[model samples]
Target chain A: MSDAAARLAYDVIVDLVGRGSRVLDLGCGDGLLLARLMAEKGARGTGVELSQAGVQAAIARGLSVVQGDLDQGLADYRDGSFDWVILNQTLQSLVNPSLVLNEMLRVGKSALVGFPNCGHWRARWHLLLTGHMPQQASLDYRWYDTPATRLLTIADFRSYCGERGINIVREVFLTDPDGGRPTRWPNLRAETAIFVLAGQIEGRPRQRP
Target chain B: MQPRSVGIVKTEYVELFQPPNELRLDSGEKIGPITVAYETYGTLNADRSNAILLCHALSGDAHAAGRNNEEDAKPGWWDDMVGPGKGFDTSKYFCICANVIGGCMGSTGPSSTNLRTGRPYGLSFPVVTIADMVRVQRELMRHLGIERLMCVSGGSMGGMQALQWTVDYPEMVLSAIPIASAAQQSSQGIAFDVVGRRAIMSDPKWRGGNYYAFGDPPLDGLALARMVAHITYLSEVSMRRKFGRRLQDRERYGYDFATEFQVESYLYYQGDKFTQRFDANTYLYITKAIDYFDLAASKGSLAEALREVTAKFLVIAFTSDWLYLPAQSREIVSALKVNNVDVSYCEIESDYGHDAFLLEVEEQERLIGNFLSGVAREHGIA
Candidate 1:
């Protein structure tokens, strides 16, 4: 009955957030991770969900969530308003994941981004044999019906961080929620990846750029 | 966790202030000997921090839940959400719902006699605003010896009171849930109220609100006002779905305006039933209070108005509620964010319109119960 225990990502996410921390969860479906974080870590969280049902479900669980689109941007929030901003299994589906990640960094002291690694062994084998976009546990739909708008791998995301001058403070590779094995080659072995990041700290007030 | 129903509640009254301790209105005037009619469920814990004050909407009375007696055909207005394990959960938290000061239902409204003239105060009663209503309730809370409340909540006008409590007495309220309401009255809402008040004032029998002395009340005017007010509470979708072009009783229309449609009959029935219990003067006064309500008028900005609010907030709006649209609730949420307040918002998907707060019981129960549970946990209520 406790859906919180069923998701291993929630355990890892909850562990990363500090006790009594203020959290902002983007694309927080039903707020399962946020709810567990509140109960276990005594954290307070606000969620933004595009789906009405997800918003209601989050509210039903006693978490404050707003019905809003991620593409619309987080203009309503102030700078560094939250201790942590979380986006789990939702980065790849967004219209502009990079912009959202930057906005998250602006509004939160730290950001946690989780996404499915498209370069996993299963996805690679399926694409090589079938010559069609692969679908597996993380990508559980046909190419046409998939919500994963873009494909990304552990390496692509790391390079994106480097190019944008974003710092990856921590990284975790998971084959699946139940399979928490750490891998030497995440892009080839891991089905999913989570990264904790901090935006480049300003050394001093920028003088014209 | 589904809450079990708590059955058979009771209502009581308490005299809060008298003479020297007269309740002061936001307008600087004062009223003496205020008697608050209220209903309480569950027991107040030793610390008394488990108390929740439930403020009612326009026509709602203090009878918020449970049946008063076996003869009563229906339970209270919020009966579904205020039981043993329901949204307000009478078992764990002490719930208090009071009839507002200007209400006609067993409260010191215009219907009460004026000690100076020994006649119903009627139009002579000083006009009170939403802030005045909250001030009276605060006095009532002091009378009951509860220093701090676990939560203050309501929808529509009730939501205004909840919001006001947070701004006016920030230290008293621990949490606030303002459902389907706004920080200020919308122009469209004011227009509706204008027509309703005109309906009463234009009636010949109204006699400038002195109809009480004649004992022949302006039932037609009051009924018409209620009819006009009721239309705003529903949406076009609900009206189309519920009545459509369906005829009333007869197979065919009478070819005249003799209650041809079922929707007409329903409105007439609702309006007629309303006249039996409500006072016309009270309708005029309360509606005026709602019209005059603008929290930011004196504070310069909404953020400034709510700067003192420390209580955690949950602001709810319904998608189909055009009277108090979701945008209005967003204004509140935006201001709260500007002040860096702890706030959460949800625009529920409902076609029930302004009445969704009353009709969407299942959704309200879950959301409210969980919110209250978290707050209760924080206060060590469990």
Candidate 2:
């Protein structure tokens, strides 16, 4: 991600997270986001990263990060262990996004999910005109070497959450790398989508601040 | 830069629990006037906060680093990782390693003379548990004027002590690194220990643990026991790579009952070398202590057991270690997570099996060095 977009995402996350709350960052590369959450939001942060180098770097930063694969599920954490569980730009790469999303909700009261919007107008036009797989700044990898097993868009994620009874508490759409103002038609225009998701809480009284 | 050694160290002894002030064993027995042999590297900071206690594994002694004498051919067992610029980094931290109570290495073990009878205690010595070992180390710590340790770390049996230290004296430890170990000894481990003990007892020279007077200890039996235990310490891959069914000193089998295979010769050498430095009775006691170790036995669950632990943890495991499986370390990590303890766990890629903790020095150096520096920064000791 570009520096501006990354900073904007971090700012949004920091603003949404309550002060001094416990936060867990899944696939926290080098623990940059977790450190920012701790410093800017007073959040007690923990991280789980798969790469050995990432884990080492996170640890060197004095972050509590366990080296683990996200695909294996979050069985180490108990139900509602953290106030917020963040998975940034890593949802599409997951082998079982549905199971992981369920696990995230089970382990945290709220989850923040971010992913590239593959159904953007530019991507669609490129695929239609070129008769090849779509390639955009967000989803730049070729189909053969892409880490994303599930190519999803803003609309696809919204429908999936709705079908699974997940409540979208908040959301933001980035139309450009500069993190311009949130776009109205995120499904077709936005390059990246971020959402604050929670499990079914219709009848329950909200305890979160 | 090449790691500098602590260099030319000496073992020291301290006597604790004299007379009426006796150490109460888990078996409800009391033993007084215990002598603990220990070695220290680096200088203790003024506030005593820079102290890092290093626990030794099953056969390891207090000689954790540096050479005992100028002419000594070999340094301490863990010299590779504990030195001036190595993992423990004596230049930055005060490192201490104490021989366990039931050890043969200059500690008050079965070989120590029982003051009452002026004879080796042998089997008469009260069975010591891992908790008991930590208790002795705690007394040693108090004697040395250290109030809180910067970290407590070790691998295998030593890792058990590190875990026990956190649960036993949570406030005393700031951080912990339990490597290649388990919360409780697995049944397979117990089975091996049992067989080793049986081997020692079946020997005629063992004489019901009264072999000291004869001046001929159970050499063959002890060697056989070491041979068996050593096999568990190595992986099949390591064994294959190291010895691959090749003949020891001959091109072909001699068609006689002799150590023909290279693996057999290696085991024999390891067993023989072990007998030279270790006492058979001490091995039995130490293995028994390892078998009796169960961190969660009294607390009902591992999470509950570690609920009171306040120290940050760094738990490590080796992928090829079937003896102390990576799954066991995961159990520790899982329990620590349940309690919301700040923990870091990694299963290092290694083919060294259980011995990886001792042999995989480069990776350990990087992980431990980084982890300790981070802990030091948090404690304001950096």
Candidate 3:
């Protein structure tokens, strides 16, 4: 993803998180978003990153980040321990996305998930015209070496959440990364998607933004 | 650039716990007129916020860096990691290291004279625990007028002391780095200590822990104990690399009940060398203290024990450290996370086993240097 899109996603997530909230950023590469949450939103933030270099960079940035793989799950945190759990720009790369998504909702009152939309028009055109795996600015990786295990679109995520009875408290689809505009027909037009999901425990009231 | 040493350091003695006022041990006993042997590197800032306490491991002393005398051939135990611009960074932070009460290196221990009997304390020295060690160090810090420490760090048994400090005096420690250590000593670890103690007690020259006047201080027993404990500190891979099944002196095996293999010869040398400095009684007491360390035993859980700990933490483990496995460090990290403490954990890849904390200096330097600088910034330390 472009730096502008990443920054826009961060802005949206920062706005979604309340002041002084506790946050756990999963797959927090270099802890940039977590640092922003702590500095700008007054949130108590922790991060978990898989890469050694990423964890080192985060620590050097003065951020608390545990070096761990997302596939292992967040068994260390208690239920409702965090106000917000974030998995941004790293959803497709996980081997067990469902487990992590469920674990996030279990551990936090709410969760914010962001990913590049694989159904964007450019990706479709590249695949349809060239008869090869799609590669674009948002999902820019060769099929052989890509870390993404499950390429997904905005619609797919919405239906997956609906099937699992997970509530989407808020949604933002970014068409113009620099402009920060939320585009319609996001599955086809938007390059990236962000969703704020409420905790799905039985009888628990949905949290307000 | 070559790492600069603290250079020509001397061990300082402070008499704590006067006759009337004594230090209370975890075993419900009190000892008086305790002398603490400590060494300091760098200068304590005016506000004293730059002070960092370094706890040493078993068989270690207060001399953590630099030479005690100009003619001394070797530096302190942690010389590689505690100097100007090294991990502890004497140039940036005031580092203090004190020998535990149950120690032989210039500290009041089993070898110290009993004021009443005018003989070595020997078995008469009250049994000490890790908490007791921390308590003495706390008194030393108080003597120096440092109310709060910027950080407390160590590896192995030293790491246990660091952990003990955070729990025993939560308000005083700003940050901690417990490397290659567990919150509790495992049964397997206790077994090793027990065997080592047995080696000392079975020797006739030990004379029921009263070999001080005999002029023969159970060298064989002490050497055997060192040999047993030394094996725990090394990995099979390291041993293979250092000395496989190779012969000691001749190309062919002696084929006798002697130190034939190079590994056997190495262990004998290590054992003999250790007896020259370490006290057998002190070893027994310190290992007993290590065996008694269990951070969660009374608190019900590790998280409960750490709930009041406000210090930021950096817990590190080595991949090949079987004595204190990576899983144990992860247990600490998990508990710290459950309490919402700011903690960073890394299981460094190394084949050096339990000794990696001492051998893997470069990686530790980078991680600890960055972590401490970040902590200093957060606390507004110069």
Candidate 4:
């Protein structure tokens, strides 16, 4: 995409958010996301990032970022402190993804979660014949460097959301197999999956420090 | 016309009732049974509702507006904004401006006698914060018999104190205008202060911050600190406009440490001139006070601390101010908004840097005048 296109998209997202709403972004790489949101939306954002370089970059970008191990917990932030907590491209990287999802549900009034789908038929064949973890376009890295703790399929995600009573406000499926236009059956054909969650809450858990 | 100067409260009366004082700073130090010095213009109404307090910046004195003497070269800094039919319009409001707690002017400062030591406190004066300055102002207001103020206004360090007042006694203030100030001093801000203090300490006559006994103050260090800080007060564009690498005497560079350029010479002149009247230790104390001023940290929650502020707010920040920056003003606005405080904010387009608060006349006067008029009308004064 063009640089201007990306910037415009960011601006659109900020415009969608209201002023003074506390925002939390999982895998918040650098604070550009938060700083841009603060400037355009007049919102206050706190980011949870993993890398030292990312944390420093966020601070320089004038966004508040906290170093955290997302796999362990997000207990520091008080419940309901955030209006919309987002986990972008980071759900599948967790050892126990359910625990983190529960924490997100607890802390945020709404959530925006995006993940990669592993239920694609091609991936099933690659796993069945090659007898190795499938290296699809979305999971590009070599086996050693790959970050998928356990692959999650589109069906699996939907079932968990339903069982846990987490409402799916919007579900977006990206089937852009190449650099070109997206196709159908994105869960099996597409590289990325985007889902925005809102409203519903279930499976209440006890508070942990 | 001759510059008019009147003791709003004479020295004797001020000492007796509204005496200036110092803090036993958070660092286990004490400042004074301070002798605050101030001047007032216009008259206080029977209801005392017409009072407007003017908080001056770091280098300011009690002479906020109006001339202190007929022989004075220039009128006070805010004189244009606070006089008959002027911005603050003292004719319609009782305007009060006091030198802050740890100031030099005629107010109690490091030079003020310490009751326990029977000597000027010098370095012994405890570092005071913006909060302490506001507290002292409150004391003065109580002594002056003013129950509530129409407004509290200032820029830079004065802005810091003005904000402290609104948060400290929200009910007492009807309005607050804090211009070109930061909620917390940035790392760069503290770096300048640190270097300034180092400059003072490096001077041979500094005497480890107790130069009063030596009878020779650390003029060199103080001048250096002023030179550093003054550079930050003005923008690069302002400096370029005022002096664009223009030579002071001959056209070519001196090729030495000598200040050959007009800008360098101007800074030197400003520094040397200020050293004649100011104290090095007082610089240390006051700058430390400013550096320590973080309203959020002290109170823990910005929203709660400002929750009681029902007063209207006019928070102004200059675009050219890299020292304070617009972000600080935004933070203040954020806190105020969370508490549902009534406020109007503007990041004024100016290239004069933080000092724009003092230099910009027409824009400032118009905004302040109209604002006060609106508020006055609400109170039935206009």
The model with the greatest lDDT is 3
| Docking class of predicted structure 4 | incorrect
Q: Give candidate 2 regions above 4 Å deviation.
A: A1-8, A199-209, B1-3
Measured against the true two-chain complex, the DockQ scores of the candidates, in the order shown, are: 0.56, 0.69, 0.68, 0.02
Superposed model 3: Cα runs more than 4 Å off: A2-5, A129-131, A137-144, A175-182, A200-209, B1-3
What's the candidate order when arranged by decreasing TM-score? Answer: 2, 3, 1, 4
lDDT at position A183, candidate 2: 63
Per-model TM-score, in order, reads 0.91, 0.96, 0.94, 0.63
Q: How far does residue B220 in candidate 3 sit from its true spot (Å)?
A: 1.9
Clash count for each candidate, listed in order shown:
1, 0, 0, 6
Superior candidate under TM-score, 1 versus 4: 1
Predicted candidate 4: what Cα RMSD to the true structure? 11.8
Better of 1 and 3 by lDDT: 3
- lDDT tens digits, residues A44-113, model 3? 8989998877878888788888988889999989878898999999999999999999999999889999
Candidate 3 per-residue lDDT over residues B1-382, each given as its tens digit: 2349899998999999997889988899999899999999999988889999999999999999999898888899999999899989999999999999999999899999989899999999999999999999999999999999999999999999999999999999999999999999999999999999999999899999999999999889989999999999999999999898888788886678987899988999999999999999999999999999999999999999999999999998998999999889999999998888899987788999999999998888888999999899998999
Alpha-carbon runs more than 4 Å astray in model 4: A1-209, B2-13, B16-32
| Of candidates 3 and 2, the better by DockQ | 2
Residue-wise lDDT of candidate 2 within B157-241, one digit each (tens)? Answer: 9999999999999999999999999999999999999989998989899999999999999988899899999999999999999
Q: What docking class should model 1 receive?
A: medium
Report residue B238 deviation for candidate 2 (angstroms).
1.6
Task: Indicate whether candidate 1 or candidate 3 has the larger DockQ.
Answer: 3
For model 3 the local lDDT of residue B352 reads 93
lDDT of 4 by residue, B1-382 (tens): 6323332333222552222544444666554466788777779988788999999887888887655555667677787677777778877889888988778887777877877879987766667888888877887898799989999999998888888888789889988889899777788999999999999999999987778877788999999999999999999998999998899988787689887889989999999998987888888878988999888886787766777788877777777898898788877866875564655555667889988998776667666776677577657763
Interface RMSD of each: 1.8, 1.2, 1.0, 14.5
Q: Which clashing pairs does model 4 show? A: B19-B36, B20-B34, B20-B35, B20-B36, B21-B34, B24-B29
Model 2 DockQ, alpha carbons vs. true complex: 0.69
Task: Give the proportion of true interface contacts each model preserves, from 0 to 1.
Answer: 0.73, 0.66, 0.66, 0.00
